[model samples]
Target: MQEITTIGLDIAKSVFQVHGIDAFGAVIVRRQLRRSQVLPFFRKLSGCVIGIEACATAHHWARELEKVGHEVRLMPPRYVKPYVKRNKNDAADAEAICEAVQRPTMRFVPIKSPEQQSVLMLHRTRQLFIRQRTALINAIRAHLAEFGIVAGIGRHGVEKLLDLITRGEDERIPPAAHACLMALAAQLAMVKRQILEADRRLLAWRRTSKTSKRLEAIPGVGPLIATALVASIPDPNVFRSGRDLSAWIGLVPKQSSTGGKERLGSITKAGNRYLRSLLVVGALSVIRRAKQLGYTRHPWLVRLMERRSVKIAAIALANKIARIAWAMMAHNESYRTPLPASA
Candidate 1:
């Protein structure tokens, strides 16, 4: 009977390391292959179990290797990090990945499909352009403030500042500074245009996506948020329950317990920062809007608001929303707002 050996892949930009052992855990193959050579090498080899650290290009390679009849598993970076010996190198890292994959407690990241990746690309690019636009606005404001000009933070503020600069409406602003401001304003406008274009395209894509549509059915979750969530959460079943979804999004408190004493602190903040941030923002909007209109007797929200600050209430709402999202996605159903517990 042929041994069901395992192989570890340490991925890099140009070079890669492959570590494998025989039935007795003896190093049978320690090979180096270039990026172009990696796929072809695997194509020629017999089907076996392969492990790789979850990072850039891991998903693509995992999908490709799986297509070739190999069982590919991707372990999170932290899981593989523990197995790395004193001196970390490609070969040792590859070996560690292999060892980690065999652990009973090991957790794996689901390989994202190309469509999921495409949606994520849109979100990443939009974030980058927004950041650049903000920087440009700040730079313009700082440069002009040398002559006593102040610009607020926002895309709208960019337009207003540009109008002020080009129109020479400000007595404190000089002509030379206005010239520099105009160029900076142009850059800001360009970035805004790029962001808008990307957002439009992303929304269009989200509109047709079944997952995004289901997510969007929930309140406070628009197309952008829905699409981003679907992309980030490729496999919802990995989470045991809806609460785990909130915890995964950093919406749950951190726990520190010792000697039969337990204390819950601030959020773990361990998962995707972008998704957490979006949820928090959405929660805040819901609360603010609710106040101006009318508040429902949601027991959790009532207790949270009375005992804690509005910020805490907002976070609780976000946590609930995260759980709701998980339930909807995991169960493959639309949002179901269960009745609030007794107040």
Candidate 2:
């Protein structure tokens, strides 16, 4: 039997399918292994290249396989989809992954460290609580509106509603409705506390990371965005240029060019939605500050605001910010302000 040189592992909750090929591209093994049998099976085989789809638990398996002296490469599932000959099944998917891993042009996902994963989890949890808080606030407002009791917009308005709920003296609210509102208010307060705790933990983690601290120097990138970018991008050098990073973050315009004509539409929005949203929100903050101050150091942004809508300008600024962030991370340098053009 020839020695296997490459393998594709399709992982699941309790079962995993493995397809392996020898140096000459001949199938050497194709079988399903129970969850408990996976490690022992790999231990008996010689070290080889392994391909895994970047999905839930993929990183954990990749790290484990690497610890066993195998070279693990994680590819986005979408990129491997094209290699599937037909009939999507665990066996077929494993075969496709095996083929895709050997392609020189195929892009692979960088394995994230446990710490990075933890920080991301923090971000996700905080976001979840924030959404829940918003829902609670909206529900409370809607319920109160039915009784002809309305508060103004923003925190002051929300406070007014909360005061009414706690006082339990508003004749407008029926006892039943007041009880429900009290329950929602309690949940909202609890979620708010959770969000604040998440923020505190995130900030604590950020202070320990020099990269996150350095990223904070970039305009429009606060501790939240800085920490997110640092945790999300494990290796900035994987990107050939700042533009590549921007494109990966889905800040680039979508292209539909054909023949000799060029057509472009909105941003592809293909990559990390969280990062994209953070950058855009940060950009909007910068724009708002610039408008209020009646000036900005970047003349380009000034010109952009003069012609383009604020939202469009915000997107463009976000793209530029993403590129700047990539350059800083890739080069291990601080953000440098570009000098104004000589008239």
**Model 2 lDDT tens row, 255-338:** 999998999999999889999999999999998988888765768999987889999999999999888888889999997879
Question: What CA root-mean-square deviation does each model show from the true structure?
Answer: 2.3, 0.9
**Model 2: per-residue Cα lDDT at residue 154:** 99
Return the lDDT, model 1, position 334: 86
Error (Å) of candidate 1 at residue 157 is 5.0
Highest-TM-score candidate: 2
* Model 2 bad stretches (over 4 Å): none
Best by lDDT: 2
Q: At residue 220, give the lDDT of candidate 1.
A: 75
Candidate 2 clash pair list: none
Global fold similarity of model 1 (TM-score)? 0.92
